[model samples]
Target: MRVLKQVLAVAAAGLVGSRAVAAVQDDPWLTLLLGTATAVAALLAYQWVVRRTERRDVTELARAGAGTRIVRGTLVGFAMFAAVIVTIALLGGYHVHGLGSVTGVVGLFGFMAAAAVTEELLFRGLLFRLVEERLGTWLSLLVTGVLFGLIHLANPDASVWGATAITIEAGFMLAACYAATRTLWVPIGLHFGWNFAAGGIFSVVVSGNGESKGLLDATMSGPTLLSGGDFGPEASLYTVLAGLALTVVFLGLAHRRGRIVPRRRPVDAPAADVTVS
Candidate 1:
């Protein structure tokens, strides 16, 4: 019931935010700013709802309630995506060109900021966390991750392989990020970094959402598997491998930290010992 309430809160916040962004579409800056404000507001509402319904600490809903760790996770996400784009450029699969408009960059940042926060809250904060309690870590990861990627099918120029790649790569990788730290901040940061880099920095087609100008104009070429074809670099084989590598790293860290949620067994809970008064 708590989970359900949280989901409703997130949805309501998102709906209001989307409408607000739409109203300000004429002004990119305002739109981005509004989007961000609404996203944060939504998350706060989600936390409030969870606390009210479940009487849970709610700090975990806010990423372990640690500002430092939240910042660290965000930076790590940016770095991970940066690594992928950098590797692609080094391989000659991506060629960078002239600088883009400052407005474009800022707008992308705003849009990405909103997206990263809201999506992470919905998928990782709500879905994965609740699901994990019932289904265990690995299965919840699979379910939520696939749902994450599958949802992207709505993006323009999306393809089967692209969706599949997202499922295997981003879906698992982002979930793993949460599992590692038992928080959503890192995954949100990672999501923002990946999207911003794809659409705003490298000037690639982001999940086939058409080309949005970034800091640079990049001409992407090479095989469909390597270049990700019409869908963009995210659909590339390299992207999947990179995501897989991170998933492995984060999962290992989580396991070592004793944070990985184990599968529930059919056996009943052991009875508490009763002592004579």
Candidate 2:
């Protein structure tokens, strides 16, 4: 029955995803917000139905607080994003946008929020947790990262290399952040910052979804390999290397914190057959 419930949840999430893609065909930013709202609503409805029918709570699967956990997670995630941007800037081949106008700044924040919520709920919340439960930690991380990249395959300017880079780089890094923090806020904030800087400030295509201009426009001329082709910095091998390094660092921290431990379920003796001897 638990397995059936998990399957149902995944199916429902897929339905929401289909709607999100269709909506994105409109204005990318607006669609992002709309899709996110729709997904949350749909999931709420599904949860309500499941609870009513099965008399079970879903919280046990992916439990975390709504207050402090989110705040701390987001702050830590912000630092990670800052580090990435700094690393990119130091590496050259990229320029950041300067907010010259109020409108542009507002628009940038809007895009950031919408994209953060949408991607976090889908990727970090549903997909990651679902895979983790069935495949164990490491395998789930790998599979989810690939899924994240594959989802962008149909984006306007996405390519095979771009998708592969995203799968191993941005995808893995974000997954590690979530796993390390065990909170959705960290991944959401990381996603927002990366996109905000890469596409909004840098004026790059965000995974081929949309183009954004932040305070300053970042121009990347050089070779496509250095510039990440049409997909953005996330598609570059350099970004992949950086992301892998970060992953290793986080994995080390996780190990030190004893995050990697054998999962166990306490065996409870079959409830004494009340009616039987």
Candidate 3:
């Protein structure tokens, strides 16, 4: 029933999105912004309500150090951006230029911010943790990883191999990040960095659609394995490998501390009662 509710909610959101897109066909930017905002807001609102009902303070979500977490997250995200720029420059001779370039940067940031909060909330906060409550951390990580990759099937440039690779690689990596750190912030930064660097800097389709402005109008001069063909960097072998390596490193370091109450717990019990039980 919980799974059913989640599926229905996603489907409803998709339906609303299609309608919104059709209604705002004349203004692409406005449409994208508004639709994205609406979806994000709705998701946040729903989650907020759930947290409230559970008597869980939403602010007490992540166990990662707040000030340090933000700094580290932002740094990791910026590093990802730098890595992409370096990759593009090495492969396709990309470069940043002009005040005009800032527009693309800002737009990319907007998209990243949206993606960070929404995707983290969906995957880490709800899905991953839900599975964790039932299956334990390792199994939940695997499930969330596959689920994350599967969710991208509707993307314009998504391909079978790419999607499969993402499921096995990026999905697992992200789940591992969340599980290890017990914080959504790190994964959110990584996600934002990966997308922005790949699309906003390299002038490639992030998942499928081309970015507003990027360093180079790259023509993938190599095979699909080298250039990710249609599914973009998220599906690229390099990204998969990189994400996997990072996940390992993060897992090694994370203390695995957080407030994830297990399923079938006595909700009404006091702290002392909980310990006694």
lDDT of each model, Cα atoms only?
0.81, 0.63, 0.61
Per candidate, the number of residue pairs that clash is 1, 5, 0
- Residue 45 lDDT in candidate 3: 54
- Pairs that clash in candidate 3: none
Give a tens-digit lDDT track for model 1, residues 233-258. Answer: 88988889988999999999999999
Q: Write the per-residue lDDT of candidate 2 for residues 11-78, one digit (tens) a residue.
A: 56546655564555345555455545654554464455456655777552244564455455456544
Instruction: Name the regions of candidate 2 deviating beyond 4 angstroms.
Output: 1-92, 96-101, 261-277
Best by lDDT: 1
Q: Which ten residues in a row have the lowest lDDT in candidate 3?
A: 93-102
Q: How many pairs of residues in model 3 come into backbone collision? A: 0
Best by TM-score: 1
TM-score for each model:
0.89, 0.70, 0.73
